[model samples]
Target: MEQNKTLVTEFVLTGLTDLPGLQVPLFLVFLVIYLTTLVGNLGLIFLIWKDPHLHIPMYLFLGSLAFVDACSSTSVSPKMLMNFLSMNHLISLIECISQFYIFASSANTECFLLMVMAYDRYVAICNPLLYPVVMSNVFCTQLLGVSYIIGFLHPMMHVGLLFKLTFCKSNVIHYFYCEILQLFKISCTDPRVNMLLIFIFSVFIQSFTFMSIILSYSYVFFAILKKKSAKGRSKAFSTCSAHLLSVFLFYGTLFLMYVLPGSGPCENQDKMYSLFYTIIIPLLSLFIHSLRNKEVIGALRRIMKINSS
Candidate 1:
């Protein structure tokens, strides 16, 4: 493989804007998105930390999710925003690789983290008596640790797979960021194996995760109905509604973007879908989690009161 080493000193990113007029508008929109993502995720992290009442397995998971969302959005959005301002959105090869790696890792982490959260909810509602035992701090840490480890590990393989290919052709990527799909057409080497690997993994992992969550929720729903009191069932359902919504939004868009048999996203459409996951979804998670969460609201009020006093 070293014989074909082009040394790959630089890559040119296509970025989100080929149109001059759209640059400022896109920049402003992304700027607002970036700001909101930062504040919302950071606020969740702070609320989780400050509120003693929120010191549960669920909040811990929420805190981890917020952190991941913040990192994930920052990984691509800031660079995207900068692209709008500059004359050329060209990024060096190493920088592009770095961007791809970060984006891939953070995104994969979110998927695994969401799975863990589903399991957490399953244990809570399906077997309340054993929730603490099943989701112990030690087990929770181990699950989260596995998610982070897999994040980088899987992407590292993909990057290595990419490294084997040659790219003497145009370096300009079609997407805003250095996405794996954009690298496919540029590779001088046959990308059959890489493409197959991506497709297979996408199907296996997403299906497994989705089915697991659905089965868990199914059991949870049945269990809730068995509860004699309406109030008890309502509380149980309420506790999981936000998570269900988050799960749906994240997986639905991801499936649309990746799972279907297509050539992948076009330049503009790619940017729009990318925005859904990278910026909007992350910001919405904060709202989704906090909207009906009295614990989070109370904590916010406490912080306000303390600050005011």
Candidate 2:
């Protein structure tokens, strides 16, 4: 299959920038990011598991998200860090594809997890009485199962479709990772079909999840307003605000990158944007959602107390 489809066996990635001045600084910066992401995400998952108070559906999804974010960051950052430290950015065709597969699946899985979390919130707020029964352990497990199944399955289609394209344009990929658009640019074969499929997939996945989250929150908004107590309304706002911010940050960046074409913050903006979503987003997720939460804070205190005792 490869003999026919790909002539560019080993592609050289033009790592972030060609400037020698920024290499060490960028390396140091991303190094800190990678270490922080790993520790924070893994620590959050452990915190959730160790704390009995966090055994609910929301925390379950949160833990899964931390897992997926860790996976997403791992798939790209190690290679990116290595590339930053060394001049060797050469990756085999198989390696590139495998890397994207992992990253893409992790990303798609994140979309689903966020969607399910939104639904969890919907049930809890909209159907307050039924939420306990509806979002029971068994049901939550099933939801998680589906989120992962679809998450993994979604990228297989892209990779399968990608394999059909032949690459002959140039072996130098101009981004940090084997990004889909970068791949399409190098393919000698017509990537219109591939682009179309990607567009369709991106639109469907993002829109469906984005719209569902919006709808859920819309209902949640009204429900919050209907509450008699000002404190209850204010508390609800505070609780959901963080979740909504994370959602907007993830979906917003993705939407802009895909829909707006060339809106990067600077030259070689693709690399910058990719770094943001792939590396920075994971770190942001922990702070924007889990770390800011009162419950997570309480759980941390409880765990610390136990360890100290």
Per-residue alpha-carbon lDDT of candidate 2 for residues 185-275, written as tens digits (9 for 90 to 100):
8898888888887778888999998899889999999999999999989878886788898899888777766655466665466666777
Model 2: runs farther than 4 Å from truth?
A: 1-6, 259-267
lDDT of 1 by residue, 103-200 (tens): 77887888888888888888988899999888998999999899899876888988888878778666768877887777887877789899888888
TM-score of each: 0.92, 0.94
The candidate that wins on TM-score is 2
TM match of model 1 to true structure: 0.92
Instruction: Indicate which candidate wins on lDDT.
Output: 2
